[model samples]
Target: MAGEVGKPNGSGGLGFKGSQIPHIKFTKLFINGEFVDAVRGRTFETIDPRTGEVIAMIAEGDKEDVDLAVKAAREAFDHGRWPRMSGYERSRILMKFADLIDENIEELAALDTVDAGKLFSWGKTVDIPHGAALLRYYAGAADKIHGEVLKMSGEYQGITLLEPIGVVGAIIPWNFPTNILFMKLAPALAAGCTIIIKPAEQTPLSALFYANLAKQAGIPDGVVNVITGYGPTAGAAICSHMDIDSVSFTGSTEVGRLVMQAAAASNLKTVSLELGGKSPIIIFNDADVDKAAELALLGVVHNKGEICVASSRVFVQEGIYEELEKKLVEKAKAWTVGDPFDPTTNHGPQVDKKQFEKILSYIEHGKVEGATLLTGGKPVGTKGYYIQPTIFADVKDDMTIARDEIFGPVMALMKFKTVEEAIQRANSTRYGLAAGIVTKDLNIANTVSRSIRAGIIWINCYFAFDSDCPYGGYKGSGFGRDLGLDALHKYLQVKSVVTPIYNSPWL
Candidate 1:
């Protein structure tokens, strides 16, 4: 399937026959609303994980490039129309941006598929459309930002205003590049803040294209900037920059810690992180075994298990453990692993070679640690970075595969006896990103949902996300929230105004 290339179908869509790929248009760094070369003139190749070939050569941005982007963002925030504009005005422009995204949905979806190795069908049907919807959601939220009048004790009146936090540095991950980018971008824009974004080098094409779309949508120059480069260079610069008022990051917890340290050492800028997870999905004996098994497969195998909130750790009650395990294994074996461009393909390759090797290593470790590999513990084909949808049974809480965030097509199944035991085992890991509960008994669902330490809880459903829902993490998974009104606040700060009544200040 990797050998199949895409050809021009001449119907405004690229066709993938065999070994053909689409050409990428946006590969340069975007600063002050213009696409330009890196100051150092250095470039890096973005690989097509499906074929292990170079898709495009992207400009490599370092501290120098970040400085330029940050300077532009600072100037835009301090002396530009964006932060000072009325919410209604901003909302109109954002609505245009969302419309532009919808207009170019096919190109964006194809870019995500070729660059990130996600299934093309899911990219078109789920990721791209969801991003556009989130943009519209935030657009509606723009005009609703408000301040409140408060009663005061003495002879004074008080009011609190929600102001833009100034320049925001958004560093997004590669797993769901477009989705995560808008998850941060929409709110920041709606809050009337200027931003400098650093996209992961692995999947920088869509972000660059979006930057262009922002310009076409009438976003003013310097309001939105995108720098494409490696994390340690461009990402570190954004984190430690003294001028950036806040930094919102979504990636691994290890990197999230470094971002926090950088923020503290620089200017104590506000930092919001949505980091890694080893989430759990609990299935009680009362759950519909067939449905539970299907959702369990979807939870871990979606996006090839690269999701930050992938429910990698699944706990089934002892009464139905064997039954669920068998069902899950059968579903895993049935999942088709082939060309991402094929609409029927259920799964695609890992994002890159490093991630591919890492997942295989974890599978080996699980085997060595005495867990039973029920199915799919090997690579799929001779070409590409594809791996089988792997599942392990009898996994203990202390096992490496169970404790760590695999971030790949891997699932660890463990058995639990009671609700108390399930909660304990679920919360034992440092991550508290998300959890799922599947049970017909409302009491069991409610009790487990309350006791489990996770940010998002899914009842009998997996990957149920919405634009209005607030999502974030606790513990090692990091802090702050994304989506909903709560996310809007992440890009805003409060200011209080007070005045003494005329001649009534004890004069």
Candidate 2:
């Protein structure tokens, strides 16, 4: 790596001051495994969300660049040697790629934290490792892809084959760029599909870094291309480009809709959207108070609550409502917040000024709606766009904070009397990405897991994840799974072939 960056471990806090971090220039787009300038030579500055200072100047790619990337991917998919390789060979290369990611975990994590304002520990422990593991998981699944022979009434032989879906457009979100990119990219590559990735403008550095790493890993040029620019320009171009075979997007529901619309207008390509969520977490009276409180805080306050499946709404049983509220407030206030480069910081600033203002506005809205502000309703520091971890009490299901997706460190607390009421309130949201239940009773766990409409349910835990498990949601949270063997299947198409055996009695 040409640039050396420092990563945070668990130590001091991530602090911020208003000063420019020297601009790191990145003017080229990665297309056909080579770095080249944009056609129009346009570029934009990427600001550090923590200090509001421009840290990098990135290429501003558009339709022409998108066209170049798609053509390259299509050429690779149609005539390249990648798909012709044996499954075992593909698996070996992917495993090596995963190992390469492990070797650069600290560097990648540092880049992600600086660019996205995600907590250092989050990037190091959760995001980077999981991303590497996802690649390995998909690598293992490469050879496991099975085909079947079928018996036919006629004197013929029948078989089924799984083949790659041509060139793919992977549109990733800003929150967890490196993590989600591999979640989509690894599987697509393992299944023999060529790719064109359009990473979110706010945090495109890490994805570009990985694109370079793909080149080093001997992934043929054009097998994986990454273009960085605004969603309306580069992103929309990728979605609607006729040469692209499919689109996999992870972002807000509104943008996902736009992607779907663009796909319809052009190729009518296969699309998988992993969108927004107004997820919920339920705390039953019988649960362990301390553990529940800790997990509950992590559910929404961790990562500054910038996750798509963040449990923003909390429903506490009436019996332990007051106790849990007190515990939650005390624990939430002490969560260390500052620079992502600081090892001790538990939370970092929101991604940028817009998100910071958005979180503050929601905090104000919560106060105006008559919800009792238990703690933290203002920005914590003067330098960066930092907001105090906020909790709202006496919250009703009808409140905007409870009904809508506020992608911030604001938690809404409501009371529920019975299991039925809890389930009903939990299922009320238009979004159903994930839900958490804290209870000791096995029956309650089973019942709530089945009752909640979310795709992933956590029993006595929150935000638990594994690369081997499928993760996604229902309703407005969007369709399609992103992890596990299922994600690889999304990149494949099934075909049936029939042939005559000996040409005996039938003739």
Candidate 3:
């Protein structure tokens, strides 16, 4: 990394002031490898979540801008050099993109920290590097994409060839903006597909910054485009666009439905959705009390509880329920909530005012529905959208907080008497995105993990994501995987060719 920026961990509670932060440089629609204004010359304010103030004026792209982006992407896919170029050549460009990310990690990290209110250290340590590594991971797969050969019964030969699926439209979520962008973009690029990204309106800074980096890395014109606007306009446009071959979306389950419906209502384009979750962390009596509490609390508190797969519904075994609650209070106290740029701050504010209010309302619902407020359930400060890490005890399965996807750091701690009861309660919700089990017993681990109908399960750990691990959801959480080789395959289409032998009867 060239720029050694960002403050180190210390005892200071204060952070870099708004004036001290890096200036917002890129805030326009990125299409055809150029920074251009929206078609109508309209713009919207991208707010700084930490202060609930406008950070910069970003281009507000609607249907017309999406159309322009799609047109550029279509031309790139049908006639441009990106799709026609050799996989190795494409891989070179992607590798260079990753390299440039490393070179300007400071500016990129600052952009996400200010735009999305993500912890700056987390951006530097995890978000930026992981996203870059995702690029490299997909880069390694670029040249290796291939098909299979088949033998026919009667003097014939058959072979299947894998090819790019053409233009892809990706709708990204506000949380984890950088990571999700690369998660969608890396695989699409590796598969030789031109992509039009509709980043969540709240956090367009990093995506726009990434677009500039993509162009600098020598990614061909029109191969990667970003439209920064709201879902109803830009996102819906991408989903319903006739020319788009496929759409990959990550957000709430309700929005995922809209994306699917639009795709079906339009050209029936392929849609892959990684949607919301009310994931559970089941704690067995055999587990370490502190470790289980840490896992459960961190799972909810990380990213200010803005993540989809937050283990918000925790089912603790009756034997260790009280002890784990005490431990959770201790750990959450130390998990300070403050400005993103503060190195001492482990958690930051919600993505925007809307999300912060939504989380607070859910916390109130937990109380109204008779769930015990174990600890930390109020706003941290007056100015920013910060909420305390709250844990609700004696939470019923039927409670509003337990039932709904409260995408915040509010844990619904419920007690279960038996292993069968634990499994049954954990699988009760409509979401099946992810689940975590903290147990030393091997039999219990195997039994409950296999029984729960979730896409991914963690044993004694949470948020254990890697570039190689396939992450997605089942049931109402929506279908399709994000990372791993499966993501790469989603952007590719398979075609089989058959031929008869010269002296065969078939000819």
Candidate 4:
């Protein structure tokens, strides 16, 4: 590994001051440990959602680039040292990768803030650190891949081996790019699979930077590759590529369906998708109104409400509905929306103009559907794609805001009377990514937790994530898991070897 680069000596914040800013590096397609231009020399501008300014002209990868990346990844899986090395050896390399990420955490965080319009402090504190920790966690699990020994009944011995599924194509969404990328990459690496990652064009800078860091961490050439492009061309190629063994995608349900279709049409590769969600946060009558209101606000407002599991639908029991709504409005007003670089800013602009326009349209739909707008229904400023945190009350289950996966800072508030009604309303959406319940009664909490069809159930907290905990979804939210030991299985295939005890069989 190369010597560590010196950390930038600034205010350690992303705020613009005195002409100091983090440098941008690694903008090209990363393949076989080399950064190169696209074959056709096509480039697309990555815009900063904060000011609607062009951040950088990133190399645009297409089907050709995807083919090249997949070929490289296939070669790496077939003949390279990465897949052939022992699990402990891979563990050391992955651990070094995690350490390097820690060393350059500030730079990576800044890149994500600029590219994804994420809060700078959150990028620095939560995204980068948590990503590094997840890498280490998967690194620790590298040598722990085990298979069961089955005892045959007819004097036969069977030994199962869990082997790498070969090349993996991981397509990650723009929201939470760093965290989501690592969530896919770490487990695949731990499972000894070579990967070709396609980061969303909206936020490709951080993934490219991580590719450079992986090289510095002594990861072999072609073991890890990153291709930055639009979903239609580069992404479709990955899904349909015959050489790729698995496709793990994290994005909208619409795109996930297309990916599944492509995979089935081409190679029938294994697909693990963590798709869209309109998750519900149920506030019971027995819950603490203040705490419930705070969590409900955070549930929909965090990351400018771009998370896959954002509890956008809030179900409050009629008994405490008015009080919780008032408290949520107060909390919403307190959330500062400003420059992402500013450390004091809790909210940032939307990722791009398209998302911004879509959110505004949903707000309009809420009004057209007769949902009462309690607070925040307009864009924050004229320059950037910033929408004020929006909340709608009296939202019917059939309303557009409540039914659709509006990936924005929009909250749909619905009133429910009984526990049975709350459970039904919570499970009403096709999305079952996550749900939250706030109540003092253990029976209510336990009942709702078991009744909800979502993958993750939070009792009193929102967005509480652990690296070891399995996370996925049910129904339209997609299938398979992302974090924890379960994610490793996505990149592995089980093989069974059998031998006759007396060597008297067909052999």
Write down the lDDT of every candidate, Cα atoms only. Answer: 0.90, 0.85, 0.89, 0.89
Residues 233-326, model 4: lDDT tens digits:
9999999999999999999999999999999999899999999999999998988999999899999999999999998999999999999999
lDDT (10s digit) by residue, model 2, range 294-362: 998998987889998788899999999889999999998898888877778888989989889988998
RMSD of each: 4.4, 4.4, 4.8, 3.5
Q: After superposition, which runs of candidate 2 have C-alpha atoms over 4 Å from their true positions?
A: 1-27, 153-156, 501-507
The TM-scores, one per candidate, come to 0.96, 0.94, 0.95, 0.95
lDDT of 3 by residue, 301-345 (tens): 989898988999989888988888889888888888888888888
Question: Candidate 4 at residue 98, lDDT?
Answer: 92
Q: lDDT of candidate 4?
A: 0.89
What is residue 349's positional error in candidate 3, in angstroms?
A: 0.8
Residue lDDT tens for model 1, 1-507: 001112211111234333356656667888987888899989998888998988778889999999999989998999999999899999999999989888877778888888889888787788999998998999998999999998788878899999999999999999999999999999999999999999888999889889888988999989999999999899999999999999999999999999999999999999999999999999999999999999999999999999988989999999999899989998999999988888889998899999999999999999999999999989989989999999999888899999999999899999989899998889899999999999999999899899988899999998889999999998999999999889999999999999888667453
Number of clashes recorded per candidate:
8, 7, 0, 0
TM-score of 1: 0.96
Model number with the top lDDT: 1
Q: Poorest 10 consecutive residues of model 4 by lDDT? A: 1-10
If candidate 2 were superposed on the true structure by all CA atoms, what would the RMSD be? 4.4
lDDT of 1 at 216: 85
